[model samples]
Target: MAHVTFKENRITLIGNEVKTGNKAPDFTLLANDLSEVTLADTTGKVRIISVVPSIDTGVCDAQTRRFNEEAAKLENVDVLTVSADLPFAQSRWCAAAGLENIKTLSDHRDFSFAQNYGVGIEELRLLARSVFVLDSKDNVTYVEYVSEATNHPNYDAAIEAAKAAN
Candidate 1:
């Protein structure tokens, strides 16, 4: 199990842990269109999974916007922002934020995605903040498990790694 602490003290997350070089666990997440999207659907394309606690928060919103902007310039790459929020809410947020490039996925129906990714917070209704970049073959190339939930990830480095993998 993976253990992550929020704000280095606020909350603790315990769940399965994913690592670089490992085959990424496949999951079925709900798309904004209410369609089921699995990792298989993204095969043959570079993918960036931005796992956030919630899109309603400042950090999550910022990350989504940043990725949405950056993703527009990337070819053959699909950026997915995942959270436990409902698909309806996610769709509303995306429209309101003008997040057109990045795809927002929801894990509210079940914890299958969270469990498979090992990002589920055991004691709370939250997911550990993380970023995973996968190659076309579904092999993890870069992974960052934020030690402190409140802090943003190293996006520049993660994006660079994703580009390099492509």
Candidate 2:
């Protein structure tokens, strides 16, 4: 298990830590339409998986919007924003934010992504702020587990990784 901070306090993360060069793990999560979506669903495309605690928060919102904008510029790439928010709430957030390119996925059904990716927060039951870039073949190329849950991720590095992966 790894550890992070929320507002400067320690928080333990539950699950296996993902590292670059590892084969990405597949997870079943709910799409905004309440449909089951898995990592295999987006095969043949470089993936940028943006994980956050909640979409309603400011940092999470900005992170998602940043990826949404970047996803439009990248070719042969798919950006998936995974959060613990419900499907309906995820849909509402995407709609309200006018995000069309990035897919909002809900891990509320099961914390499979959380535990598998090692981003789950044991204290709050939320995902730590992190971003992962996977190549078309499902190999992790880049990973950023934000040291602080409230801080932003390295968007430049993540985008560059996605570009390089493709």
Q: Over the stretch 21-71, how does candidate 2's per-residue lDDT look in tens digits?
A: 999998999987788998889879999999989999999999999999999
Best by TM-score: 2
How many pairs of residues collide in model 2? 0
Give residue 80's error in model 1 in angstroms. Answer: 0.2
Model 1, range 35-118, lDDT digits (tens) per residue?
Answer: 999889888989989999999999999888988888998888889999999999899999998778889999888777788888
Off by over 4 Å in 1: 10-14
Task: Give TM-scores for every candidate, taking all chains together and pairing residue i with residue i.
Answer: 0.94, 0.98
Lowest lDDT 10-residue stretch of candidate 1 = 7-16
lDDT of 1: 0.86
Best by lDDT: 2
Quote the lDDT for 24 in model 1.
84
